[model samples]
Target: MRFRIAAALLTTAAIGLAGCSTGAQASDPNGPLRVAVSPQPHGEILEFVDEELAERAGLDLEIETFSDYNRPNEALTQGELEANYYQHQPFLDEYRTEKGGEFAWVQPVHLEPLAVYSKEHRSLQDLPQGAKVTLSNDPANRLRGLKLLADNGVLRLKPEVSESARVEEAVAENPKNLELSTLSPDQLPRTVEEADAAIVNGNYALKANLKNPVAIESAEGSPYVNGLVTTPQLKDDPRVVKLAELLRSPEVAEFIRQNYTKETVVPAA
Candidate 1:
């Protein structure tokens, strides 16, 4: 859900701002821009921008962290935040399509590969028949997990199954007869010790210190690069533009390379 990061930890402004702003012009144009983010790479990346780059660039930022995937966009839509950074275009598309809103994806900042992690097994081949496998509960991520399994030859999806296919319609073959289950994305890492395998998002994997994975989604030609998203009016805001530039800057890219492995967090090309 939506929660404030302690001011000391985030180095941000106080979280209790008045609500009711409808768009970019609704809030003080010169005030610190409130941007919502996930705690791992998203928040960390913005923290770099806030502490290192913002002042010099003449931008002020207030960072809000969220645990639930739905909260950032919800807050943004309600004007509690000016913008957000934590989702790919596909996830954003699904959210907009289902929930009905007008939001713009600014630009891709990094790619966090979906991965298969397990504490009970060393490799996918080691998973025994009827092994418990858990995937994140969201539709886009669930389909993504299914694709990751299919890529590894553990399961076979239907020939005609598209990207939007549901979990049931996509699974055409299950050679291991694996017992698949769904859990919240945040819960996947905690289940690693109990389940035979879990297909986890790269951000959550890193947060839980699950750096090494048996298999990971390839970043090359991937459309799932997480980026900045804002309302239509805020898309052209000077502060938003400056922040986007900083997010894709050489320094930010270097920070990503030095701090995160290519497997976990890859700077967008």
Candidate 2:
């Protein structure tokens, strides 16, 4: 896991060294809206808009599919993409704070609920001591995933920890001493099949066809619904507005609500 993280960091650094637009040649006022997206719901939803509604609305949509959780933000920051739809506001807040980038938020399109999946263990209680578990490593998601452990009595967290908490902030009262590993959200689904358990992002879960999670984040109060994001300068671009409007339309919402399992993917209101 350590080796994988190191390699991922190196990949990120390579992107920085190679990419240089800096959100300058940002977006076309009337051209295709180049947007980055995760491979599942984000990509699937955008493809729907692009094929079914874009021409009618006079919006030419170009979609860039990103399988890596970190790259979309980097691409958006580097102007390799005009906007992205693969992250929540918490992630955007953490990214802005970490990179000092001015990524702006549009409305949330859908919710990919975080879930705990395991091929080895049927439930959290079944997980034995020192069992290796993989989770999303990014600050916001690390906190959110860890809170599932805390919430389900598998572990305990420090008092006053809010939605933005990180793994290092976690003071676990884990009697089992479950060995925890943090990976990118995109990596968790695959790792869970090998490790004792994993807290996977719903998008990856469905993409990989991993099923029957032992635990899930509820839609009632979950905050990780993915939204459209853009550079501050392009926030009000007509293309962006049209894309956002189409994404949240009844048509798209019905597609999400029908095409995906309600437990794994929920259309955000």
Candidate 3:
């Protein structure tokens, strides 16, 4: 396994401290641990830890924020970052397979339900035939979004298509003949403005302040909860472990509920 789960957090924290004890960077008292995160909630959550919790835990935290979801895992795999906090396991699994890099994830901290927001359409049924609908360009999210549409009776996948099916396999049935277009997670908001509606990652939806999406991923047992992803080498680094702990702390949970509305983001179970 690229990242082995720790038997207990105490044991992991001890391992992390051991790696961080030496002046690895030689300048700071606590060696700097570089982590990549998404802008809205992940970055906000990290900022809080970087500001409020890390110093007390004796961890020097540095943040790299990404608008696009592509760079974090690539950075981690290439040794540019120690860990990242913006992606779910399904995405990590698909990315590792597609991009040919090894990656692993820790326990999830939060679920950012993918949602569909519209500028012109009042409801999915109301959207005219051939209405352009933007979906995630990434296969995992695209399939999930298409599945949401499928569950709602808007479209269906071919019988042979698996749960993680991509766009090519998704036209099993389109009664309304709605035109589905693909867009990267970052661009979904702008695409939604131009198109009839777009299934959007929750962070981007919140960043764009898009209201009343025609569809949203069900929060119950959603596979899209974001978590810490790290290279196998740094999986036990104390600073990384500390950051993961802080991410799941009560304070962070309260902060998330307070800052981002409960209706959108929820702490992972």
Tens-digit per-residue lDDT, 1-269, candidate 2: 00111334544553664465435454546556778777678878888887787778887777766556677787777766679898898888877777787788988888888889888788999999899888887778888888888878888898877655656567558778888888877778778658999898887789888788899888876678889999888898888888889999999999998899976788887
Clashing pairs in 3: 16-238
Ranking by TM-score: 1, 2, 3
Best by lDDT: 1
- After superposing candidate 1, which stretches have Cα over 4 Å from the reference? 1-25, 160-164
lDDT of 1: 0.84
Q: TM-score, each model?
A: 0.89, 0.86, 0.83
Per-residue CA lDDT of model 1 for 1-269, tens digit only, reads 12336634432332223233345336668678889888889989999888888889888888887766776787777777789999999899989888887898898999999999888788888889999999988878888899889998888998866656667778999999999899999999998888999899989889888867988898988889999999998899898888899999999999999999876899998
Backbone clash pairs for candidate 2 read none
Q: How far is candidate 1 from the true structure (C-alpha RMSD, Å)?
A: 4.0
Q: How many clashing residue pairs are found in candidate 3?
A: 1
Task: Give the Cα error of residue 201 in candidate 2, in Å.
Answer: 0.9
Least accurate stretch of 10 residues (summed lDDT) in model 1? 10-19
lDDT of 3 by residue, 1-269 (tens): 01121224423443454445442222222457777777678878888888888878887777766544666666666565678898888888887877777676765899888887888877787878888999888888888888888887887777656545668676688988888888777888898769888888888878888777777778888888899988666667776778788889999898888888654678887
Give residue 243's error in model 3 in angstroms. 1.7
